[model samples]
Target chain A: MRIGIYGFGSIGRLVAREAVKRGWEIVGAIDIDEKIIGKDIGEILGFEEKYGVVVSRDVEELIDADVVVHATSSYLDKVYDQILSLVRLGIDTVSTCETLSYPYYRYPVLARKLNEEALRYGVTVLGTGINPGFLLDTLPIVLTAPFNIVEKIVAKRSLDASKRRKSFVEKIGIGMDPEEYMKALREGKLTGHVGYAESVYLIADAAGIHLDKVEERQEPIIADKDMIIGEFKVRKGEVIGIKGYGTGYKNRKEIIRLEFHAYLGAKEYEEIMVIGTDYEVRWRSTGTPGDQGTVAVVLNIANIINDLSPGLLLMTDIIPFKPFFKH
Target chain B: MRIGIYGFGSIGRLVAREAVKRGWEIVGAIDIDEKIIGKDIGEILGFEEKYGVVVSRDVEELIDADVVVHATSSYLDKVYDQILSLVRLGIDTVSTCETLSYPYYRYPVLARKLNEEALRYGVTVLGTGINPGFLLDTLPIVLTAPFNIVEKIVAKRSLDASKRRKSFVEKIGIGMDPEEYMKALREGKLTGHVGYAESVYLIADAAGIHLDKVEERQEPIIADKDMIIGEFKVRKGEVIGIKGYGTGYKNRKEIIRLEFHAYLGAKEYEEIMVIGTDYEVRWRSTGTPGDQGTVAVVLNIANIINDLSPGLLLMTDIIPFKPFFKH
Candidate 1:
C-alpha cells in the first residue's frame, strides 16, 4: 500500500515509521513548514537513513498515494481545507483530530459537506484516536449492548501531565499562580482540554439520547510542594494542575458525566461506569500513556479506511478497533 | 421467521414471548416435561390468549421451524444429543448452555463434531447468556479492540443472589451448614457457577494467547448476620453464598483472572480491566439482573444468526451485539 503523511509532527512521524515497518510504501509527505520543505522524509524525522521521498508543500504530490495519515491539528475547522483537498483527490484518510472524532455532533454543517465531497470522489475519511475516540465515549456506548436498558453513564479519565507533552503542561497552566491561571482560563488562552465536551456529546449521540443541555466546568488542583518535570519547575502554593468536567442533561437530570484531570504527579488511569436497567457496568485501566495510545489507534485504523463507505464516520460505523498483531 | 422453542421453561418462554411480540411466527414448541405436554403455549404461560401452538415431545416436530431457541440445560454434555439432532435437521440454534459458550476449551472433541455437523447441514449453532456470554468474557474481549497490544486481562462479576432465581440460591448452597455445603460441592450436587472457566478461555482465545494452564477455585461466603431471602433463612456464621475464580497463566505469569461472587444481598456489579501496552481499560456495571440480561442479549442477537456462516460460533465471531431498538 502506498501512503502519504499529512502534518509531519511527532504522531505523523510515528505513523510513517510503523507503516515502513509493515513494508508499506511511503509515497510522499505534505507539510506547510518551510524549513523541511525539500528534506528527505527520513532525515526530516531525525533518522540517519533516507527514504528518498521528499517533503512537499503541495497536496497534489500526494494524489497518487492510496491513503493519507493526517495528524495536523486538533479541530475540524482548522484542517477543513487540507482534508477537503485530499478527499477531492480520491485519497482515503485516517486522522487524529479530536473534534473530527465525532464532528456530526458539533460541526454538522462541515461534517455533511466533507461527507458529500468524499462520496462524490469515492473516498473514505475517518477521525479517531484514544481519548474522544475510545477511552471516555465510544467504549462506554459499546459496553452497554448486553443490558436491557441504560439509565445513566459516568466516565472519568485522569492523567499525570508531567509524563505528557510540554504543550499539555502549558495548556493546563501548571507553573502559573491561581490568579494567573484563572486569568488565562477566562481569556480562553488556557482551555481545560479539547475532547471532554466532545466525548460527552459523542456518548449522548451514540446512545441515541437527546440532551437538553451540555455544560462544562474547570477548576485548579493546587500544588502542595515543589515539583520538577523535564525542564519545567513548579513551586509550592501554586496551580499544579487542572480538572475539567463535561455533563449532558436530559429532563433536568445529568445522564452523562465526563471527568478529566491532568496534574504534575496525578495518578494515571481511565474509568467508565454505565448504569443500565438490567445491569450497571464499570471499567477501569491504570497507567495508560496518552501519545502512544492515540498514535497506535490512528495507525491501527488506517488500513480499515478504504473498506468503509464514504462519510464523516465515527468509530461505531467502522469495524470495531482490533489489535494490530503482526504475524 | 418461524421460531420453535425447545425447553418450554422460563428462559425459553421468555424468548418465545419476545419473538412473538416482534411479529415472528411461533411454529412449534418442544419439551420433554410431561406436565407441559399437550398444553397450548399461551395457556401454559398463563396468558389470556392462545397462539394455536402446542408443546410436543418429539424434536422432529420442530423440523419445519426456521430456528430453535434452546434453554433447557446448562452443560453441553447434557444437551449434546439435543443440539446434534437440530444441526442434523438443518435448523439453526441459539442456546443458553454455559459450556457451549466456548466448548472448544474443555470439550474439544464434541465441539469439533458439532462444528462438522453444522457445516454439513449448513446450519449455525451458538451458546450465549448473561454470564459466560456477556458480562464476564465477550464484552471484555470486544472492548479491547481499540488497543494496540494487550498484556493482561482481569474480569470480575458479583451478583445479588437474593434477587436472582431459586435455582441460583440452591446452586450456591445458601442457608446450608458449612459441612453440608462442602459435601454437596464435593459430590457435584452444587458445582461452582459454570461459566468462569469458559470466560477465561474465551478471552484468552480472542486475545490470541495460548494459556499454559487454566485453574478454578471456590469458597463459601459465610453469613455475618441473620438474613431472610424468600423462604430461605440464613443464620450468622453459616454458609450464605459462594465465590468462584478462574485464572489463566502463561509461562508462570497470571494473564487472565475471572472472579465471580454471588450471595444473598451481596453488592451486585460487574467489572473488567484490560492492561495493554499502550492503555489499560476497565468497565463495570451494577445491579444487573441475570435473567433479564440474558434474555435481552439473546433477543438482540437473534437476527444475526441467519447471516453468519454455518458452524459453532462465538459471540466474538459474529457482529458484536447491538441494541434492538424498535423504530
Candidate 2:
C-alpha cells in the first residue's frame, strides 16, 4: 500500500514510521512548516537513515496515495478543507481529529457535509485517537459487553504534564495563574480540551442514554512545592496543571463521568470503572506513553479503512480494530 | 419481533426473558423434556404473569418465529441437526454452542454446511456467550487497540464452583475422585469443558496469529479441606474442581495464554493482561456472576441479529455487541 503522511509533526512522524514498518511506501509528506518543508522525512523525524521521501507543502502530491494518515489538528474546522480535498481525490483517510470523533453532536452541518462528500467520492473517513476515540469512549463501551446491565461508567486519565510536550503542557494551562488562565479561556485561545465532553457524549450515545445535560468543570492543580521540568521552574502555590471533569446526566442522574488530570506532579495512570447490574469492571494501565498510544490507534485504524463503508464514521461505527501486524 | 426458543433450559429461559423485555413475542418453544412439553414457559421459569406461550416437542413449531435462541448443548455435533432445521425453516438463530463459536477450526465440513444452509435460507446463525465469545477472546482483542505492537495476551478466569448452579459444578467434575473422573472422560460422558481452546483459537484468528501448535492441559483441583456446596460435599484430597490452560504459540513462542479455574475455594475474578511494545494493560472484574454474564451476552447478540450478514458466523466476524436496552 502507498500512504501519505499529513502534518509531519510528532504523530505524523509516528504514523510514517509505522507505515514503513508495514512495508508501505511513503509516497509523500504534507506540512506547511517552512523549516521542515523539502527536508528528508526520515531526518526530520530524527532517523539517521534516509528514506528518500521529502516533506512537501503541496497537497496535490498526495493524490496518488491509497490513503492519508492525517494528524493535522484537533479541531475539524481547521483541517476541514484538507480532508475534503483528500476525499474528493478518492483517497481514504484516518485522522486524529478530536472533534471528528463524534462530530454530529457538536458540528452537525460539517459532519453531514463530510459524510456526503465521502459517499460521493466512494471513500471512507474516520476520526480516531487514544483519548477521544479509544480510552474514554470506545474502550469502556466494549468492556461492558460481558455484563448484562450496565448502570454507570466512570473513567479517569491522569498524565504528568511535565513529561509531555511543551505544546501540550501550555495547552492545559500549566504554569498559568488563575487570572492568566481565565484570560486565555475568555479569549478563546484555550478552547475545549479534546476528550472531556466528547467522551461523555459518545458513551451516552452508545448506551442509548438520552443525556438531558452535559456538564464540565475545570480547576487548577496548584504546586505545593517548587518543581523544575526541563528549564521550566514553578514556585510553590503556583498553578502547575489542570484537572477537568465532564459528566453526562439522564433524568437528573449522572450516568457518565470522566475525570482528566495533567499536572507537573500528577500520578500517571489511566483507569475505567463500570458499574453493571450483575458485575463491575475496572481497567487500568501504568507507564503508558500517551503519544505512542495516540499514534498506535491511528495506525491501527488506518489498516482497516478500506474495510469500512463510505461516510464520516465514529470509532464505534467501524469494526473493532485488531492488531495490525497479523503474522 | 416474534421469537421461538429452543432448549428451554437455563440459558434458553434467560433469553426468553430478555426477548420479552424487548417486547418480542414468544411464539413457541421447542424442547425435548417431557415434563415441560405442554407447560407455560412463564410458569416453568418462575414468572407469575402468563406469557401465553407453551413448550412443544416438535421442531416444526418454530417455523413461524422470526428467530430462535438455541441454548441446548455445548457441542456443535449434538446440536447440528437442530440448528440446520432452524435455518431451513428460515429462522435466524443465536446459539450458545461452544464449538460453534469458531466451528471452522474444529469442524470444517459442518461449518461450511451450516453457512451454506444459512445463506440458502437468507438467515444468519451465530454462536456467542460470555466465555467462548466475549471474555476470553473478543474482550482481549478489543483491549489491545491502543497498542502498536502486542507481543502476548494472558487471560485468567477464576470461578468458585460453589457459587454456580449444580449443573455447572457437576460439569467441571467437582467432587469426583480421580478414577471416577477418568472413567467418565473415557466414556465420553465428561467431554472437555467449554471455551478454553475455542477462546485461544478465536483470539489467534482475530489477532492474525498463525499458531504452530495449540496446547491444552487439564488438572484436578483437589480439596485441601472439607467443603460443602449446597447438598454436595467433598472431603479432603478429593477433586474439588478442574483447572485448565490453553496456550497458542507462533514460531515456538507463546502468543496467547488462557487459564481457567473453577474450584470450591477459588477466588472469583476475570482478568486479561496484554504485553505490548510500549506498555501493558490489565482488565479485572470482581465477583462477576458467570451465569448472568453468559445470559447477558446472548441477549445482547440477539438484539443485533438482523444487523449482520447471513452466515454461520463467529463472534469476531460480526460487529462487537453493544448495550441493547434503549429505555
Candidate 3:
C-alpha cells in the first residue's frame, strides 16, 4: 500500500520509517520547514539517505496518496480545520493529535464536521497513540473480554518526568514556583494537553453507557529539594508535575475513575483494570526507555485499519488491545 | 425532639415508631386517608393506641412540629411545590422521597430553588433513603480511605427481585410485555428513581472531581424465565429488573462508572471497589431478606444523625458508610 507522512516531525519520521520497513511505499512527504523541504526523507530522519522520496511543503502534492499519517503538532483546535479539508478530498487518515482520539468530548462540533466530511468522501478518520488511546481505550477492552459479566472499568497511566523533553518539563511547571504553576493551571494557560476526557467518552461509548457526568481534576507536585533542568532551577516545595484524572458516572453514581499522571523525576507505572461479579482483571506495564511503549501502542493498530468502520475511531475500537508483545 | 410524620405510608409509620423508640415525642401524624385522619398514630400503625396525637390531613398542622419527616408519595415533581412551601416556613425537614437526594440532577431549577429557600431560613433539608443515599454515596468513600494512592473508584449494587414490592415489580415490567416496558423506558415514563445520578454526583463531589459530563444508562431484563409471586404470574422473557449506571469524565476521559441494580426475582449481591497504585480493595455484602438491605442502609444513617452535619449529605459524605455491622 502507498502511504504519505503529512508532517516531518520526530513522530512522523518514525512512523515513516516503520511503514517503509513493513513494505509500504512512502510515496510523498510534507513539511513546512524550509530546511527539510525537498530534502531526502531518509536524511531528515537521520537514517542513511537511501530512499529517493523527497519532502515537500505542498499539501496538494501529498493529497493523492492512498493513506495519510498525521503525526503533526498537538494543537488540534488550530490544525483540525485544515485536516478536515484534506479528509473531505477522500483521504483515509490516522492522527496522533492528542485531542483527536476522542474529539467528541472536547470538540464535538469539529468532530462531527470531520465525520460528516469523511463520510461524504468515503474515507475514515482515527485518533490513536500512547496515553489516551492505549491505556484508556484499548487495554480496558482487552482486559474485560475474558469475563462474560463485566461491571466496571478503570485505567491509570503514571510516568516519571526526569527523562522527558525540556518543553514538556517546562510546560508541566517543573522548576517553577508552586503558586505560579497553580495560577497558570487555573487560567488554563499551563494545563496539560486535552484528551483524557475524550478517553472516558470513547470507553463509555464502547461499553454502551449514557454517562450523566464526566469530571476532571489535577494535583500539583510538591518537591522537597531544589532541582535543575537545562537553564531552569526549581526550588524546594515548588510545583513540579501534575496528576490528571477523569471519572465516568452512570445515573449520577461513580462507576469508573481513569487517572493519568506525569511527573518531572518520579517513578513510573501504567495499569488498566476491569471489575466484574466473579472476577477482576488488570494489566500493568512500566515505562521503558524513551517511552517506547507509546510507539508500540500507536503502531499496533496500523495493520487493522481495514476492519474499522467509517467515522472517528479511538484505539480501543481499532486494535485488539491485548498484550501485543506477549502475543 | 418533637417529630411529626407526614404521610401514613409504610416508611412513615416505621420512622415514627423508630423515633418513639428513641424517646422522641410524636406530636402528630398526617395522611390523606379519611378513615385514618382522626385515628391515633398507634392505632393506624396496628399497635395498641397510646400516643393521643391524632392523624390529620392538613398540611399546616403537620408543619407545626419542630421536625417533619416527609415520607409522602414517590413522585417528587408533583409534590415539590408543596414541599418547598413547607421549607419556606423554616422547619427542619428530612424526606424518604428518593428524588430529593439529588434533586439538582433531575430537576435543577427546583433543587436550586429549594436549596435557596432552605439556606434563607437556616433550616436543614435532606433527601435520604437506602439506595441512592448510602449505597452510591457513602459506601465508595469509606472503601477508599485506607488506600494511600487511589487511582480509580467503582461502586456496584445488585439485588434479587423475588423480595421486592409490587410497585417495583410492576415498574420493571416483571410480569408484563417486553415491548411495552422498553417503550416506557425510552419515553422516560419508567425511570425507576432519580437518585442514582445524584449519588454519582455526590461521590464525585466528595472525591474532589469537577466532572464535565456524567452519563447514565439502563439495562433491561432480557433473560427467559417465569417468576410467580403471590397471585401475580410474571411471564417468561419479560423484564424483571433494570440496571442503572453513571460515569464521570475529565479532560474528555472517563475516570469512574457508578452502577445500581434492582431485580425482583434474581440473585443478590452488592460491591464497592477502590483501585489504587499499591492495593485494590473491594467490599461485598449480600442482600438481606425482603429488601431489608435498603432499609438497613437508611436506618443506619438515621441512627447517626446527631453526629452528622445537619445539612443534606450523600452516602460517601456520611460517617457511618464504613462497615456498620461486623459479621
The fraction of reference interface contacts (C-alpha pairs within 8 A across chains A and B) present in each candidate is 0.34, 0.48, 0.00
- Top candidate on TM-score is 2
**Model 2 spans > 4 angstroms off:** A228-232, A319-327, B228-232, B319-327
The clash count for each model shown is 15, 0, 73
lDDT by residue for model 2 over A58-79, one digit each (tens)? 8888987888988888888889
lDDT of 3 by residue, A247-327 (tens): 888766666678877776666666667665444645454433332333333443443454456766655454221211100
Candidate of highest lDDT: 2
**Which CAPRI category fits model 3?**
incorrect
Candidate 3 residue A237 C-alpha distance from true site, Å: 2.8
Per-residue error for A206 in candidate 1, Å, reads: 3.7
Mark the 10 consecutive residues where model 3 chain B has the least summed lDDT.
Answer: B318-327
DockQ (0 to 1) for model 2: 0.35
lDDT of 3 by residue, B146-202 (tens): 333356678776776666666666667665567887788789777655566677777
i-RMS, each model, one decimal: 10.8, 10.3, 20.5
Which digits, one per residue and each the tens of the lDDT, describe model 1 over residues B151-244? 6778888888888777777888887888888888889898768877888888877655677899988989998888787566889989888999
